[model samples]
Target: MAHRHDDLAGHDPDADWSLPGWLYTDPEFFEVECARIIRPSWQIVCHESDVAAPGAWRTLAYLGENIVVLRGEDGVVRAFHNVCRHRAMRLVDGDSGCARKLVCPYHAWAYELDGRLTGVPMRRDYPALALEDNGLVPVEVEIWRGFVFVRLEDDGGPSVARMMAPYDHEIAPYRFEDMRRLSDVRCRERQVNWKNVGDNYSDNLHIPVAHDGLTRLFGKSYAIEAAGWVDRMSGQLVDRASDDPWERFYQRHLPPVPHLPAENQRLWLYYKLWPNMAFDIYADQIDFMQWLPLSPTTCLLREMTFALPDERREMKLVRYANWRINRTVNAEDTWLIERVQQGMASSSYAAGPIGRSEVCLRSFAAKVRDRIPEARLHRAPPPGWSRRVRAI
Candidate 1:
């Protein structure tokens, strides 16, 4: 278990330690992570249903890329740079909408739904500009179980389907391909490194101590385990009544999801993928939480909720109750992570020992250090470290 960058690597292989605090606060460290870990990773962009028709499209602003995902006339979904091919003007505005053509607001340049340049304000003004050659620049795209995923820059690694194969059988029953969007992607900005949010998601030990509603619902049944690329957590709801009205109502009215097994009906499962994607699966709905880094100290959290079509009054009630309950959980996590960010930034702090049972957090930290070996340093490297040194 000796790592190439750290002299202390020879310590027991099972030893779990949190990443150094400098890694969280250093701007140089963030740049290294973006190049080594973020750029080449696959990102879940949108569900197919979000752009179900040829004219439907959605945009994602991540790291520094302005990407638009859309369905074409031939029924194929594609991704392209959101910039106009003419003069680099943004081709789309806002989060999502249906458009017959992607027209640039700056110069009136237009593109077909599939990104083929179709119209320019002055057609004969530039005869040298070839329409076919000047189509929008495409980004890599893959659809997994009807969910659209794109890589900002490809690194010839495994596809999302390949990486997710370990849990394919378990997730098959949910039939993500058949589910439809319950809401648009909700954006939440926070003053913390992206890893802080990710580390919080993989953390299980904090729940009983910090989330009162979750403690009342799941009690001591929560569990977490890690694989090389994903972490799984599950908790079965307690039969005992909860004092919280939302939790009680949810438990009482959670109608039998006929498609799921008996055990699954009462279970809440969460899966965190390598780098930045996480799925919160309930029998009633699936919620995705994806965190993307903006700077050394800021990140954006994008969330989307999906569910199978059901119009039953009880089912609707259950869905609303579920939102109310999880809203509390998310707020609790925000407070905890912001505090972690502030604490990690303090001169008094270095690194702390991770509790023995925090396996998921340990795995995530190990992966980070593995991806960017410099993350093993107790202090931030010299400025210009990213450009002056090669990590991998």
Candidate 2:
């Protein structure tokens, strides 16, 4: 059904919309978001322990940028653009590896683990070539609770630690720093806008209607709220049996985690940072993902799971059961997102109303409009609109 733009956006008390439909479908708006929102936002690359040893490295590719998170000889974790300064050739390939020095495969230019230029082949041929000033360009890095986060450009926003300070004390007992990686990093592509993924994750209104297993586990205890820069969500697993085999297995086999507080032993937490960093903290494991914008209507999902070492047989079974349960939730979400994306593309649809009490959705919309006011428009601004605004 068709809805008037102004009435949906302002006049009708029944309708409060998030980003307009065109915003999700516009290539120009996507470009602006990548430059204005994604570059400055912190992205989780890998856990610090992933690059624990000297010279260990992991590569992250996101929204046209490639990054390398390396541990230097001095045992410090640092991040830098993945391109060689000599010819912009990629130095490291694949997900992760160890190297004594970053040597370019193209020209044999070498850099120290700390990103200082060390060797260049045929040094005398280019007498004016200054190795001292040509190391890999650095990216800002932050390690919070064992996660390594990097941003292409410093936006002067709060560090990851400061941004999540509200929940630090409560989550401290989880001891994430001691957790070990449990699975290899995985990635997949989705044919929907990146914001669709975030919006679905933070929207608790869909749980009872969308995820029955989650409702079975958490009952009515699943809660959501917006906390400044983060959208916080959690559900306390009810101490009861489930008819679903997977959920039942988890409910029966999941043992008490001695390290976590009694209340958190069965709690599952979800936190979405300002842009697209999502932390899914569970009693069995913590799984984090970066929903990166790949194109106007497609996004990349990269994630890995981590947890404390537990060799017990049932604990292993519990983790597997948990995976299966969430796997279904993800598949269901994919179906829902594709339907919405298709519906929004229709000639008639303009925007959908977001309720006022929907704190997470409201918070997300406000943040987008705050950074990119063009998002407030009912349609995509004309070409050169940004320049016109700048001139004014």
Candidate 3:
């Protein structure tokens, strides 16, 4: 591919065309993205609190690669490609656990929490095998605030902290490290391109028309702001309470989160991190979502919610109400994006102009172009293009 920003400079934001529809449904393009974009990007693995103690470990699959993040005996959190050195077999199976040593189920090769190959089942048979040279390969790991992120590629871009520095103060008040995850990671499969899901998340223009419940709650105050590679969409809850019994009851009875300011008590904030992560903050809770692509036209919306533990009866009820409300919002988003995906597959549909509120979408698409230059094509790439660009 051409150098970064080479193909993207020609894009005129005010009068530019959206990405060609076929890009959403092309297998070749998806393969390119897997190689050039997703593999090299930093992905949220889990909260720091998830692997809080030595021996605590978490496992996940990213872009078809299995990854393991664990807390070592020295109290350092480390990540590794979840492949046993002995036979290229999987090292970890489930989501998380607390284990002193990771024992490969295939051959019983045990590795220490720090990824050192401690025991080879048949030590005498392989006398030439050097223990010093054989160990689980490490993945780059970083912790920002409370979230843990791992870079799969050895030579990826800047650290997550540097990329996120601009919003440090804004995110500090949440004390993400102090908050605990409220549930297990929940995922829902949707029939839409991952980029389409990202485009939908970055778009504030559709809030009024597509998200009726949100419109009723926040009115027309939704606004989008950009800083570096991050975008924030914010709106204040309408002062006039809703007529719906659940909404009214929660607003009237549930107390605002004590740590947040009076103004923030009624704010809805969504921060879009480039590529595929979003942190959505509400008055009383925080939700992180990852748009993990399963194929060209399918994705898994992996989501998790977090908050300071509360024992109040009314607050529990309010949290349940909030959960119900988010379900409605997500359902609305699913319906809208799936329809858009269906339209993209149709022969009659073509690229459309973006509105002002969708400037973030344009910027995101530009980032995609920077990573995969051939995204402008309305059909599959030339036979050699993917291999050629991937070599770069």
In the range 153-218, model 3's lDDT, one tens digit per residue, is 844566778767777787777778898999999978889999999988978778878887777777
- The lDDT of model 3 is 0.81
Off by over 4 Å in 2: 1-15
Clashing pairs in 2: none
Instruction: Output the lDDT of residue 107, model 3.
Output: 84
Prediction-by-prediction clash tally: 0, 0, 0
- TM-score, predicted candidate 2 vs. hidden true structure: 0.95
lDDT of 2 by residue, 82-135 (tens): 999988999999999999999999999999999999898888898778888899
Query: All candidates' lDDT scores?
Result: 0.86, 0.86, 0.81
Candidate 1 ranges with C-alpha deviation above 4 Å:
1-15, 121-124, 390-392
Q: Candidate 3, TM-score vs. the true structure?
A: 0.93
Each candidate's TM vs. the true structure?
0.93, 0.95, 0.93
